[model samples]
Target: ATNPFTITKLDVNEKPRYSKEAFKTSTLQRDAYNYLGYSSTRTMMLAQYLYEGIDIKGETTGIITYMRTDVTRLSNEFVDAAMMHIQKNYGAQYLGKYQTTKDQNAQDAHEGIRPTNVLHTPEYVKANVDVSSIKDEKLFEDAMKLYARIYGRTLASLMAPAILEHTKVTFTSNHHDFNMKGVRLLFDGFLKVYEESKNKDVLLPKFHQGDTITMDAIVSIEKQTQPKPRYNEASMIKKLDELGIGRPSTYASIIKTLIERGYVTKEKNLQPTDQGILTSDELDKFFKDIINIDYTAEMESNLDKVSEGNYDKLSILKTFYEMFIPMIENAKVNMKKIQPVMLDETCPRCGSQLVIRKSKYGEFIACSGFPKCRYIKKEEAPTDS
Candidate 1:
């Protein structure tokens, strides 16, 4: 706060928030419509297929470079390869230079999204893989097309930094600070391949610093702050990535696990279920130390220590078990009194009151007045028959 010498120059008139005036503002909604229709697992399967390889045009060809990467990196080899392909196929002008990013956190292990072999375009593949001629061929075609888009994005990323010539038109109407900032594309760069990603810029005729622009209309619109949106898969993964709580590979599994454990449910939005709330609350109350944030932090630290041979994993587990056993016993002794469960609903087939029962699989409702009623809600399959 005290270092003025190290301060960076700021654009005072810049709009901090995303503009609603743009044509393509609903990106999150669009992505949800695209990917979330099929379950996360199925989507991953198709993407993997596209990434691996596809048999098209009577020759085996790879659609995409690779999938399952969080890194926004492009190798020099890949860049060179792309440039070579572009020159050979399109033209010399299509070939672009490598892109530079200031983000030091970018993973450099994998190249940016590109076709494994650009010689095998989607059109070439479609010629052999007819839509109606074969089953699952259409699915392959769709995946291949998406792969082409990814490849285009990689190429565009390698192109020159898109320059935006910003112009601010200021009109002081009744001493109100009303200004409209506009931007025009200074250089199109890689947008030739992937123009959909870029937002259309508004072109202003021209303006000087002191020029008094005429007010077209005074439109005062009242705005209210929107409530935070429910976390989507992409945004959730991004947050997890930022917190360093989970790796890129584990992000999908974490979400999946949360669902499987009944910790959360994905309806129109992801929400914690009653079971999740109860479980978390009970655990927090009875096992405060174990459930606390510090405990998790310490556990991570200890795991790192164990990995480095500074601590023994078995010893840590043994110590934890020793402490936990007594707590379990204490909870069992001190916990609420047990009440016998009963089913209120009657058997659909028989007019008899249902009773609560247990089996190896779990618990269910069975007819208590069963001998005469001949009603049984089978909890589990009979082991023998």
Candidate 2:
């Protein structure tokens, strides 16, 4: 029956949930992509400048700490300052309990990305920042926006969790039960600093148990399960973080390397090119056991252990060599070589046929007779990352 029904049971509960600790490298990149539409490379570049120091007035000021870090814990000094700021600017109740990182992948090398000084607000940075010696206007604006995000996130991390009152209503008819849920904001704690669209509350009309409530109608909505979407730069970083595939310092470079090599192209999402697919397929065929997520993640872990003095770097290198050296030799014997494309033009240097050869950079024209004629046609301008 598509009609109104009496509320059989109404339950409401008040709960408090904390926001995330702070912005780690992965989280910062993800948020920047989601909120500011900034690429990982772009975000990291701006963050580097901010960390290196910005010129405000006559003195140089470093607004943010190191950009590449996995840890979410702020320094004790920063936390103490933030707490004071929170208590003074925001109410005393806004002060939050300290949170610690549980991520096993996190290194203690650096604290999470945050403002070096809480008082240097976004507005201050916007008006005072100079990105270059000549002072780029656009760079100034982008830097300001990124700084604001970091500022808000850092303060929010040290604030108390938002309190919420959730109410659920259940109705039963003909053995079929329907449910309605509502949310009410009880306290804006961390939300005072960092705001998100999801933080909105859905206030419901007051209803008691066994009260008559109008359903309006029971309409059937057809929905199909959709396949998972491709990873954007942000989501890709997140997946890499989850798998522990790379370090904080390497995430930007990893994505940049993939894109630079023509392996992956960044459009709306990160799409693998033909070269990437073929490379992966060939590697999988010959080195599936070794060239995999598990191996990479394990190597990262070993590297971390080495950094922490828990494992020997030489032993790790020896173990890796034992496994990788044999694979290279086996591949050389069995794997098919990618033949270079022969170019119509001949090499003027050695009177040999020129061929198109690919490297980390784009394809370049080179002599096929490499041992005899080591001639390469240089491009108009060379570019290296």
Candidate 3:
């Protein structure tokens, strides 16, 4: 029997387990389609616009607070403003105080997502932008929804904790343990508008914790372990963040660099190709002293110190290049020769090796032999373009 299942952030490399019912089904293929095809990036970009700001209402107006944040802490001013708004607009009973406990290690420098101007309602701002501007309208709509979520959470934090009733059901067959859980919501609390995220319990007809359940059927299936999935943008960002290897602004650029250098491929998600693995391995091997983990960490620290005025900037760069020089020399002498990876499959005109060349159009393919071959490829636009 085939197993149907659902998982969240399950590392993208897990065997599907048999289950009678499931929700939020996801797979490597599904994520690849969503991200590799640019849908996920486009969606995030739209969300960022709403979170940041956009040219709407004849002025650049941002809806929610900054999107790129790990902080759960809200500003005191924002909290005060929200409480005032709730008291005036909603009611005293609807207001609840919440305190989101944050870990000391987390980077919570920025406040939680909030409205730039709580007074600006979605309908009020709608008249400011052109009716034909779908981009502005979409951005405005998303901003308004996120604003509501942040505002609602602020209110809910102060309210009494939501109460829940739960029951558990267990079924066993063929010496295998199977378990199921159900929950029932006792109060709506602050889950009025945020109902979609509310975990409504699956109310089971009265059953005790020790209740025995009869098995209707037993099913078994063969399964195979799958290899680790290639890194996708979001997961890669998370990984990079965890490693402390790069900053918020650098992760996207690093991934883009890997793609441009043929170190990685984006198809079926961002998989490090053979060349990528080889190149990374080679660099790490011969240039270990320059590019290894310790070097990177120390260099980052020095850069931080420089920014803080404790160290000179030029001296750091000089020290880096000075250390790198010997590594380059040693690699030139001892490293095995490797051919440069070419991106284009073939020359546009002569079917020769299409070596990449720098040009006004950024980068282009031309015959490797150049002048003697005298062949250049100009990009032509097709109807599909």
Q: Return the top candidate by lDDT.
A: 2
Q: What lDDT would candidate 3 get against the real structure?
A: 0.54
- Candidate 1 ranges with C-alpha deviation above 4 Å: 1-39, 86-113, 128-134, 172-177, 195-218, 260-262, 286-343, 346-385
Span of ten consecutive residues with least summed lDDT in model 3: 17-26
lDDT tens digits, residue span 280-322, model 1: 7777767786766566646766776787799999999998899
lDDT of 3 by residue, 19-95 (tens): 11100001111222233333333434644666655557566767666645545566677668766776776567556
How well does each candidate superpose onto the true structure, as a TM-score? 0.64, 0.81, 0.63
Q: What 10-residue stretch in candidate 1 is worst by lDDT?
A: 16-25
lDDT scores for all predictions?
A: 0.56, 0.84, 0.54
In candidate 3, stretches whose alpha carbon ends up further than 4 angstroms from where it belongs are 1-44, 51-59, 66-72, 83-113, 119-167, 171-178, 182-206, 209-218, 221-228, 333-365, 370-385
TM-score-wise, the better of 1 and 3 is 1
| Model 2, backbone clash pairs (residues 3+ apart or across chains), number | 0
Candidate of highest TM-score: 2
* TM match of model 2 to true structure: 0.81
RMSD of 3: 9.3
